[model samples]
Target chain A: MPPFSRFTALTEQLPASVPFVGPEVQERQAGTPFMARLGANESGFGPAPSVIAAITEASATVWRYGDSESFDLCSALARRLDLPCEQIIVGEGIDSLLGLTVRLVVETGTPVVTSLGAYPTFNYHVTGYGGRLVTVPYRDDREDLEALRDAVLREDAPLVYLANPDNPMGSWHSADAVTAFARSLPDTTLLVLDEAYGEFAPDGVLPPVSDLAQLPNVLRYRTFSKAHGLAGLRVGYVFGTAETVARFHRVRNHFGVNRLGQVAARAALEDAHWLDHVRAQVAAALQRLAQIAEQNDLQPLPSATNFLAIDCGSAVRARSILEGLNAHRVFIRMPGVAPLDRCIRVSAGPASELDAFEKALPTVLAGLT
Target chain B: MPPFSRFTALTEQLPASVPFVGPEVQERQAGTPFMARLGANESGFGPAPSVIAAITEASATVWRYGDSESFDLCSALARRLDLPCEQIIVGEGIDSLLGLTVRLVVETGTPVVTSLGAYPTFNYHVTGYGGRLVTVPYRDDREDLEALRDAVLREDAPLVYLANPDNPMGSWHSADAVTAFARSLPDTTLLVLDEAYGEFAPDGVLPPVSDLAQLPNVLRYRTFSKAHGLAGLRVGYVFGTAETVARFHRVRNHFGVNRLGQVAARAALEDAHWLDHVRAQVAAALQRLAQIAEQNDLQPLPSATNFLAIDCGSAVRARSILEGLNAHRVFIRMPGVAPLDRCIRVSAGPASELDAFEKALPTVLAGLT
Candidate 1:
């Protein structure tokens, strides 16, 4: 039978593809679970014990829908961030928030600027809304701020996405540089400053929340998925000026945030000691990953995030090494675009998972040779 | 300062209002919790113990993202419904699915049809996407199927929404009538047949899953929220022809479903005994609600779902009774539009909650007199 003939022209034009191929899909195809799940940048340390307790307690009340306004969680976040609740909007995840943000600004043929190998989910949302993507290439594995600004100006783009303590490459810029870049962007161009890895970065890497909170054109996105260890809970939030963040309510799925996710994230925020402990563990794991890479004759790039990008000299070698690691039951990822594709990205995990990666690396490298 | 200047024209036109005000928001305003929680149609009996156990067990793995494809849950749903997995797409909730469905079909100024007082979320989504809603009024407290067909034909709408065993009024249409209505619509007009209350409905109320599964334009949306008692988990699925269902992947948040929600939903779906137990309880509660309404000199509408609509003779009396019930800490709701607004809607919950409503009713009615 013919499909529904009336889907929007934009939806009809969209390709039947997803932003990321999930690890579970890969596992199903391979017929075995990866021994070391070092891809996707999920926290291996897991949520704090208090968070687990909160989730367990919340399980009994699963019949009650989550507070559509996300009152308590937003209140807690407001207190922690020194912002008003009106300026914060909690959503299912960064991906959901990105989709909503895209819907707000994008229309057919609207220009959106981003680094060529930036977050695929952001790009997916842009294209899903029929926004014309204008790509900027990475300079030395870091998103080229000047070129991204130039594209925004050249194309009169209304949206731009930048991830700090960048993914896939694990590189970062100084706080001054990021602030300067934000100041340089046209006020009409909304800057989606994604700080998904902010918790793991050094003190100077992230500007104070207050620094950009006044910018109406900026929305900073963060999540518990990375350092706080609740990727499965799917809670994320964006903070901006009250006028800008309040607009999300007009378009968002009001009850989309899960109840246990709110409970777990609130508890996770209160457990500062757990975060510190995980930070230490992540630092140690990053060291172990670097050592593993060096021992196997690969270059480990300096990182401000909880992952290392090991340069394998060329994109072809990186691809082969990634496949070889996968065959040995180690799951790792790489940048999708060239230049940065010369590296394999491995998330920092517990010592045991790192041990699997460490053990498999030499064998995979030797096989590739 | 001003808001971001470049939000799409449709977004600027949308009012910053939500479809439903949650009970939590009400509690915050009243500075006290409601003794009886029945407003949102959530199951007060809660999810099965086995589902809670599954949730607690899955809490430990909250660091890993949920299976993006929702593979196992979709597989189980497909097996239960006798449909192919390719025909199913799981999302955060029915609300999210409805939003995505609207995005797929409704462009700016596109015409959509629905009963005037049906699911407001569906209407919200249509308007959020700039669709012009063409509403048919309820006939004798049920969605006027014949009129709805006429409106669809009149508007040549590309989308229409119908809730069987409907919300707010607790009314339903026979399966044969519903099937005939589906057949009457233009094949180009996609029907969103929401069966959120399907479980509480009688055997003949729902058409066989296979009957509509073969239709390319008929999408059936179901959820774990109503009878399965997992509202806080925010899990819902839609099934249709494989070609039609595949369109959601291009626009959906692939990782939006939380991990424990999937685990909890899978367990809830498997707990048939718990569902049967809840059904019996709901039937008894409905009878009790009818007795309470009759005692208060109000008319109880016959219901096939988990809630009843108690007619108070006029919209003013219904409004007064609803406010009175709220003042007495009995959380019940009334339909938003006229004709339907002559009744106050109350969900069937545990007897204790119903007792609070029964105790409050006489005083509320006396105050109205």
Candidate 2:
């Protein structure tokens, strides 16, 4: 069982861990399936009918490997984003893209800046690359843009990560503020703008794709996992200047993106009507979740993403609810680190699942009382 | 459009080129679809009905990211391979796994060894991670095992790559020779045994999975992309000592493997009947292709793979016939270097597609004349 003694020093020093425990893993551990599967911020509404049809059609052609270049999908994305095709690089997900971006700049002991408990996946990549993490605490439950900018300059870091309409907290900075924050970063630093949930963000929360396209240091990523509801497909893309995205081609698995993902993503993009409908449904679900929180004397933070961070008043209380829900077969996740962990994160689910959450919360909390 | 000036020197120097050009790209350039889609070594026979059923049923679950741990798929694979679940780590593909392996061991200017014109993706990853490639030419259409071992020792390489049932030329070394190669390497040097087409190789051509499992220095890769007819799903897994597989955890995109791929691979593993059928078909097609090569006054090399490389007397003649096939809407590929490029490589397809090849080869050759 001895490991090859020759792995890079950084890899040997790292511990085996994952950024998030998948709901499936929870089900296996709990030995019971969740009554409500809203933990991972995946759209329970599912992909459009058209997307399903496309997938079924592609199932026959699954023998041929997907285009390593991701040509058609990138072309489609470029047209949609109003950027040239050269500016885009498709990947397995924003998670993979983050790892690639980190590898491009981070080396042993390299300083990388991000909010303390933002996207654990980004931090995982930084640590994987042997980069020292410099974290700025969240301010007012939002990624503190001013502090992040300061940290980048103070550390003279080469990499900075921010997620707009952020995960876990589901709070966001305005597009104008993000633009200013990106502009403020040193030219030596690469800014990774993770907008995995941009399709569900409120108006003015996402800047125009062109807004950051020309910045050599900025890489903005988006995914079909959110409103498009094809998360199981694992297709997301990053776009910036041709030179910026071109670097991805050098290190990327040209065939990394799967064929099912490519077909589903293309179909999802063409299903504009379905996107609008899903967005409306997500908005409604957010409202319903907020109402459920209000009824329970819990504070639901403002959300511009598919999930809401419900304030349970303290981290201990939030932990209790999370454990209780899992015991009750209601799978949910919270932010890993405090103070973000004080708020239990719940994703928008269909009415049936939300109803299960509504029915279970009071009883679980009452038993605690 | 300039890229950032601060990229790692390795990233800056790596070329924008990729390993494989997708058949779709070739079709686009050909301005016509192929009559016989026999390139890239895909199974035109397609997957089993049960596998497609699995994919369709899994569509409703596409909203969730695949299990980051990929436990179920790994367990299924372990059972299939008679290994423990801990021994297998599924990845986006063999291509992606190779990249991770390189990242684990390779630093700038780290020496790496492979056959000249071996799998380009492996070379890409080595160059990507700043590993210097030392290539040994094939001997009598087979990877020169002695030269590879000598290079590994002389260059003090930490990593080496070998593909059984090699691509660009469908050649294979005996399983005994392969085991000897793995045993001959230094314990500090890791051997990436790429067995992508192992299923097509004769029984004695691939070493047993357990043969090299005890060698912490050895990792074997297998994929559903070829004989199993799931290439587009992008599922490839590597099995090594638990120690080496553990290193993948330090950097793998846990959710990088898509949901459908996980399900399809699990389903394919369950369908032993389909695998047997495809193997027989591939063998017969190789026979048919050989006969056609003789009809064209070319020598077809003995193949342990789904494709055959016919010696067309010269590299120029091979290129002319390959180009003529494309002009005839009969898609095929050839090796890139001399000796190998003197042969045209063709994959097996369904009867009708093979019939297209049977009909078109003579006319295309006549047109060349």
Candidate 3:
């Protein structure tokens, strides 16, 4: 049957494609579950016992809608981030927040700037809002700040996205460099500073909140999905100047965040010990993964995040290695663009999962030639 | 201190008002929790025990992102509804789905039709997307379907909304009447038939799946928030022709639904015995509420859903009664517009909450003059 014919012209022109086909879809297609799930950069170490306890406790109270204001969670986040509650706006997840952010600034044909192969979800939202995307390529496997600034000025883009301790490549810039880049942007441009992996980065890798707190043009986003291991719960927040963040109140899904997510996130925030434990475990796993890469005669790119990007020499070789590992029922991902696609990205997980990857790599690589 | 100056013109013109200020906000302002929660129409009977078990069981697996496609939940809903999986789209909630539907059909100055004050959340989304709403006043306290269709034709509107077993009034029209209304609208005017209270409504009040299944312009929205008592989990869905539902895939946040919500919803759908039990309890509670209204010399409207609307003679009297009940820590709501505001709305809950409401009504009525 013909579809509803009244959708907006913009909707008609948009492609019905998603940013990523989830691993579960792959498992269903292959008719088998992967032995090792190392894609998506999820913390398979799992949420803290305290967080799990909180979720279980909150399960019975699931009849009441979550706080539309998310008052308590925001109050708790404010104390931790040293920002006033008015400067924070919580939503379903960073992806949802990114969509709202784009909707606030973009109209048809409005220019948006970002790294070419950076977070596809961000790009998806930009296009979904009918914004014109202006992309800059990465330099030395890192988001090139100078090129991004140049593109923003050239295109007069209203928005730009940057993820620190970057995705797919697992690289990062020092706090000084990031702050300098933010200061260099025009006031008319809003920078979406994504720090989803900030918890796993080294101490000096993330800029102090106060460093950019004075700028209305900068909004920093963080999530419980990464370090806290609550990806499935869907809670993320963005903080900026109080005046700037209040704009989100104009368009956000007020009751979007789930009740158990609020409970789990608040408990996760209070558990410093578990966070430290996950950090140490991730560090050790990254080290082990580097060794495995070296043993296979591959170069492991340095990462300040919980994943390693091992260069497989060429894009074709990387593709073959990825397919071979998939044949062995091990799930992992590679970047989408040229130079970056030469490496395979693996998230830090439990030892057993890593052991599965370790066992599968040799046979896969041996068959690659 | 200024908000970022680069937000779009539409964003600037939009007000920062929310649809409903949650009861939690009121409790915070009152400096105490309510003795009873009869507002927001939440199920105080809570989710089924089996559903809670499912949530607790799934809590540990939250480290993994929920399946972006919502394959299992959609598959289960398809089986229960006897529709193809491709015809359904699961989302964060009906509120979120409403927003997406408006986005797909609306642009600046686009005309949309609905009853005045029918559902503020739907109005909020229409205005957020810059749609011009053409409203028809309710006739005799029920949605004036003939007037709504007239407005759609008059405005050449692309969208219209109707909530069955309506909120704030607890009144309904027969399935045949609703089907006739849907058939009268032009194919270009998509109908958002909200069935949030469908589970609580009397059986013959809802249209059978096959009644309007062939109309690409009609979509039905249902939720677990009411009869299934999973409001805090944020799971709602829309079903239409397979071709029409595919448009949501172009713009929806792929991973928006939470993992525990999907698990709880699946379990709730399967627990037919529990649903029947909840429906029986709600029937009893509604009877008790009607009696309580009569004891206070008020008129209780006939209801097919799980709430009672009692007329207090005038808007001023209704406002006074609502304030008095609030002072007694018994939370309830009133309609927003003129003739409808003459009544107060109370949701059916557990017996203890009903007892609190029953006790408070006499004192509130005595002070109303």
Candidate 4:
């Protein structure tokens, strides 16, 4: 029999496809696990021992639902960030939170502005909500902030997304530039400022909380999945003006954040020393990765994020290298669009994984030559 | 200054209210923890030792994102249910799945049918999507199946919701009657068959998998939160025809299900002996609760779920008893609407928790009288 006949027109038009293919799916098809798991920008240095301990301790109480308000975790984050708890909203992750943000603003034919090849999941959400995407292409391996601003005005878009220390290309804008860009948007246009890589960026790169905390039209998103190494737990938060953040309560899944995630995230926040340790490890790994790239005659881009995007000179070479890496059981990803597609993105991990990547890259490039 | 000026009209119309106030919030308000948690229908018997072991074992790998496909858990569920993996969709919980279903089918002013005091979270999702709700009042403490069918036909609703072995009033319909009710709906009207409590119900009370598996309009949702006792992990699933289930992929948060939740749920499913133990405990707890109600001169309603809904003879009396119990540090809940509001609901827990409830009941009842 055919499927139910009365799905919304928007739902009917949506393609049955996921944003990114998970490494596990690739493993299943390849009949083996990847030797070096550096894809998808996950932190392989692992969460703090305290966070893991918290999760283990909390497992016995798995029968009780999490606090619907996420009060304890929110309070902990508020204390750490020096923001009022009312200004923060915790969610399953930045991905689910992005979907919620899209749902709240986008209706059929609503124009949403975003950079081309920035984050496919954000584009997926906009299209799922029937929002017409207005794309601004990257200029010089960076999210072209000026072009994005121009498109928002041209399309009169209510929503615009910008990820600083951006994905696929590990480029970043100065804190002053980002602040000026956010200030430029009209009051009617809400800027979804994704700072997923904020923790890894240098001091001058990220805007202070006080700089954008009071902006009603800006929502800053951050995640524990990156530097804190809790991607598997799926915990993230968005903070904005209290009045604006209140809207999430209207439509959020009240008990969506799991109990263990809440516990793990709170513990992660308290462990400042562990975060510093991961940062040092990531920095060293990135240096090693750059040396490997230089040794293989590839250009490594300057990075503010945990991952480095190496220039393979051409899209064809990049594609060939990605495929060859897969064949060697080295899982890595690359940009989806052109120009930027000339680079392959690799995340920082332990020395052993980097050794695997180093051993595989020379052979892959040789094969390509 | 003010909030962002351009949230969608549906979002503006939505009130910033959650479906249920969690017991944790109340404990904070009261500045003390409840002595016994018998509300929210959470299984206090805890997850199986095997499930906890799985969560603990998997906690060390918290850096990796869960498989977006949820292949392992889905495969396990398929083997157990004798349904193809293509027919299953795993989500954070039934709440998240319900929201996705509403988003798929309901648009602005789209007619949707459900019982008056059924799952408020489902209604929240419908309203969040701007669906017009057509409520059928419960008949004889159960969902009025015929009345629901009439309303669906009359309003041409694209969606209808029913929770068999229902919530708020722990009553259920026979499997044959439920099958007839599902078959009665028009092909255009999709039925959200919530079976969160299915594991606790007697064998014949739930429709056999084959009876409704092929019906494109009927989707069955079950959870690990109830009988399997993993509410805090936030795992649930929906199964139907392959084509219908495939629609979830279009909008689902690809990595929303956490890694440990997947592992824990799979372990819970494999431990059949633990589930049987929980069932036997629930049966005994329900009997004990009924006896306590009878001793307090209240009428205990027949229940097919893990909770008992005792009729307090009037809504005012029920409300008074609930307040009095709160004063005694017992956490329980009641229905939100009339007739059903004449009862107070209590979940089955361990003997120590039941002892706390037993000690508090008579005094609260005497004060109410």
Q: How would the docking of model 4 be graded?
A: high
* Per-model lDDT: 0.93, 0.88, 0.93, 0.94
Cα lDDT tens digits, model 3, B244-332, are 99999998999999999999999999999999999999999999999999988999998888788899999999999999999999999
Q: Individual DockQ of the candidates?
A: 0.89, 0.78, 0.92, 0.89
**By lDDT, who's the top model here?**
4
Lowest summed-lDDT stretch of 10 residues in model 1 chain B? B208-217
After TM-score superposition, what is the CA distance of residue A354 in candidate 3 from its true location, in Å? Answer: 0.6
DockQ-based ranking: 3, 1, 4, 2
TM-scores for candidates 1 onward, in order = 0.99, 0.97, 0.99, 0.99
Candidate 3 lDDT tens digits, A1-369? 999998999999999978988999999999999999998899999999999999999899999999998889999999999989999999999999999999999999999999988999999999999999999999999999999999999998989999998997999999999999999999999999999999999988899999999999999999999999999999999999999999999999988889999999999999999999999999999999999999999999999988999999999999899899888998999999987999999899999999999999999988876
Higher-lDDT candidate of 2 and 4: 4
Give the clash count for each candidate.
Answer: 0, 1, 0, 0
Q: Per-model i-RMS in Å? A: 0.8, 1.3, 0.6, 0.8
By DockQ, the better pick of 3 and 4 is 3
What is the per-residue lDDT of model 1 for residues A1-369, given as tens digits with 9 covering 90 to 100?
Answer: 667888999999899878888899999999999998999999999899999999998889989999998888899999999999999999998999999999999999999999988888999999999999999999998999999999999999999999998987899988889999999999999999999999989988898989999999999999999999999999999999999998999999998899999999999999999999999999999998998888888999999999999999999999999999999899989989888899999999998899999898888888876
Quote the positional error of residue A40 for candidate 1 in Å: 0.8
Query: Over 4 Å off in model 2, which ranges?
Result: B367-369
lDDT tens digits, residue span A1-369, model 4? 688898888999899878999999999999999999998889999999999999999999989999988899999999988999999999999998999999999999999999888999999999999999999999999999999999999999999999998997999999999999999999999999999999999999989999999899999999999999999999999999999999999989999999999999999999999999999999999999999999999999999999999999999999999999999999999999988999999999999999999999999988876
Error of 3 at A85 (Å): 0.5
